[model samples]
Target: MDDVKQNVQKVPKRKGLSNKGQENFWGYVFIMPNLIGFTVFTLFGIVFSLIMAFTNWNLMKGLDKVQFVGLDNFRSMIGDAYLSASLRNNLILLIVVPITLFLAAILAVVMNRNVYWKSGARALYFLPYITNTVAVSTVWQALLHQTKGPINSLIARIFNLPMKQTPGWLSSSKWVLPALIIILIWQALGYDILMYSSALQSIPADYFEAAEIDGANAIQRFFYITVPLLSPMTFLLMILGVIGSLQMWSFVQLVTKGGPGTASYTIGLYIYRSGFQTYRTGYACALSWLLCAFILVLTLIQWNGQKRFSID
Candidate 1:
């Protein structure tokens, strides 16, 4: 009995997973649900949409009616006046990215200094970014009213102009895009400022100190040292900003409904209108693919340019 007991004790317990293996197993187990969800919802949706781009699969007509039309959807794009207008509007909105970047950098520099209520100021700037888009859109709509809005009212009083002389804003096609641009700039400022402020923290103080010691004024120091140091962040923000601007449709849909005769139309808004409003799901998918292609090309150009210009 003693010998048997010794043998039993000497026997290694049935080999199981090593500690690292067990940890990895549990890690994968914990992430499995999210992984599955992403595969099914995101990946599958992308594939499905790509396939649908070549078919006339209107939801109203049912999946059985999904007729493959080859490149008919794409071919139709050349004659799409609405799509052309949306593309033009999208190109125009590209200006928002640079303008927002410039303003955000300035504001970030100011916020970085020892200003009063610094934390409060940062929060105030970021508030609009986190606020509900619908609420912001609604408020802006009221504020940008042609004659009755407070903005026009203030302009009339300050400039000594009549209400009729004030810009039509959302009502007039001539001014509608500009009005949208202004609203977008205001709404975008908060996020950009937050990004710039965070990037500012990572920059070493040595550069600024050296600049000041070299007899550089505030403006010169800002232009030479601060801006150069922030180039990487600026590049990242530019890409994100451009993508966001291209994908922007919620504000257009909610505030102007791409109204004033398509002045505020965007590719994204047109896609939504095509898919849901008109049940042209196939056509919408084609347009979406086009937008995707444009973005991809633009992003590639930016990446290559950065690689060429960036320091080794």
Candidate 2:
């Protein structure tokens, strides 16, 4: 009887271990497809590109004729005028980020309150974010047309300005970057608002109630309680906005095509033009690696600084 009881316990122990192993096996099986795809597509491509960045591999000459050029490709970018112009344009567009965040936070706060048609308002704000970028760009292109666009028409009507004075938004070099920044802000606003709204909802209502009990006014409570707690979300959005803004190219490409004289050219467009249009594959790879480094450094800085302001 004692031997049989020990044998039974041993059997269950083995069965439990077997069952746990099976569970792990199925888990891996379920994730294998994604793991394989990520390895083959993303990881391999990144490694290959990094390698190419150090080699002079003109596509016309084929991979067999590739030569290791050390840092020659990187050195060439030191005085590249287009690169400088692109960097400057990117810096200019960075302004859109803070303005958009501020506006989105305000809208989110308003939307979170008890209001009629709140669901509809939320949907309306988020619609732009979900819309296809190409379609959005195309629509904006028509709306920003120099001759017949509604934006200029509105300006003319409101300010009683002449057609010439209304400004050529997409056509002129001076206004193209600003116009693109506006469209970008409009497109990005919806997502930021949604995020802020969610973050606001997550904050405990008792915090606000306590502030109110202390005789804090609405604006005071908002600034002290709401903004401080929302700092984490703001930090997240700031990082994302910075990264996206730095690599902004699609809207510029679709709208200005690097402008009247490369005035609105961004680093991303510069890289694309270098790689495909100009067939400077090696140089483009180097540029991409440099961009990657820049993003990484910026991200690390933000991460390190999060402790200063992040409530959580």
Candidate 3:
């Protein structure tokens, strides 16, 4: 009886150990796909780019035994005139991003007030955001046409203003960047408004009710109750907005092609021009790595800031 009892106790312990091992094995199996992909794709890509950034490659000659040039590419771009223009454009977009988000928040507040026609309103606002960029940009091209355009004609009607000429948006350097920003903000506003609106909805109604009873007006409730709770979303939006603005290339291309003396050029477009257009792969990669570092810093800062605020 003693021998049998000892074997029985050992059997249960052995089964428990076996079960735990199986559970861990399955967990590893499930995560293997993503782990493999990250290593193969993202990690490998970063490593390849990091290596590429140190050399000079051209389209005529491949990376065949390329000589490593340390920091020349980085040094070259630092004082480049076109780079300054692109940096200026990026800065303008960064400044405009917060303003755009604020506008979106205000729009969300008003829209969230009444849910009677919510679906229609959402579709109306989000339509531009979902629309094809090329098509919308083409439409914008027509709208901004200087001579014999609807916008000019409309201006002629309102205030009976003498419409000498509508601004040639893509054609003129002065209006190109601002025109690009206008369209970008228009496209971005709706999505951000809806994001904020959803975040607002997630906030507890009791807070609003309490504020209501305390004689706090809508604006006061908005500033105190809503904004604070929505900080996480605001932080999220700003981070993404900054990233998107920094890499803003499509609208810059469709609208201006970095023309009008490259006034509307951006880092992304600049990189593209360097690599494919100018066949400076190494220099392009250098630019890319620098921009990547900038994005990394911004993302880290936002994440750390969120942690601080939440903890505080």
Candidate 4:
């Protein structure tokens, strides 16, 4: 009777194992399409681009004409004056990321409080984020026109100065970058506010109630409880903001076109012009890899620092 009982238990165990195996097979089947697509489209392209970075192959040349000129492209980047200018422009724009994030956080905090038409207010703030980039750029272009733009007109009237004396925001090399930064900050503010609002909402109300009970004022509660708990989201936004700022191109392209003598040239614009405009595919690939490395290093730095402030 005991032997028969043991045999019955072994049969159920074998059946359970078979069921688990079948489930695993089906799970793999379900994900196979996405896996294949990613490998073909993204992974293959990245590997090919990395290989191209070491070669001297313009698009006009056949694959058979590709020559291995290892490190030459990389060395050229060191002395490339345009590359230096692009890096400088990107670094200047990096200031916008932090400022926008800070302002967004404040807006989120204010919006989180009980207010009339809060939903509508939030939507209004986020409108710029969803609006078409070209349309937004064009509107701003009109608004920032050197002579006829409303912004310049307002400034000229306020200061009692000639319209010509008013700053040439989009036209002047000195002012173009700052103008771009302002527009970018305005455009990005809505999304950042939304992200921060979501993060704020996720915090438990009980935490705030508890802090209040312990004699903490609103300001104290915000800095001590809210900020700490929001650190994870803050860190995430910082990383993403840095990455996005580094790759910023469209605004510069549509607004300034890296113009007034390439003063607004960013790495992204440089890479695009090199590959598509100049047909220097190899050099463009090299520039792209350098950008990838720069982003990777910065991301790793932020990741490492997260442990100090992130909740988990």
Question: Top model by TM-score, which number?
Answer: 1
At residue 145, give the lDDT of candidate 2: 90
lDDT of each: 0.90, 0.87, 0.83, 0.89
Candidate 4's residue-wise lDDT over 140-166, tens digit each? 999999999999999999999999899
TM-score list, all predictions: 0.91, 0.89, 0.85, 0.88
Clashes of each: 0, 0, 0, 0
Ranking by lDDT: 1, 4, 2, 3
Span of 10 residues, lowest total lDDT, candidate 3: 11-20
Off by over 4 Å in 2: 1-28
TM-score of 1: 0.91
Query: Candidate 1 on 42-151: residue-level lDDT in tens?
Result: 89989999999999979689899899999999999997989999999999989999999999999999889868998899889888888888998889889989989999
Clashes of 1: 0
lDDT of 2 by residue, 1-312 (tens): 999866755664444556557668779899999999999999998998999999987766779988899999999999899999998888788899889999998888878886799989889888989898899889999999988999899999999998789989888998988888888888999999999999999999899889899999989987898888888899999999999988877767777789779889999998888888887888899999888887898889888888765645
Stretches of candidate 4 exceeding 4 Å from the true structure: 1-25, 213-215, 310-312
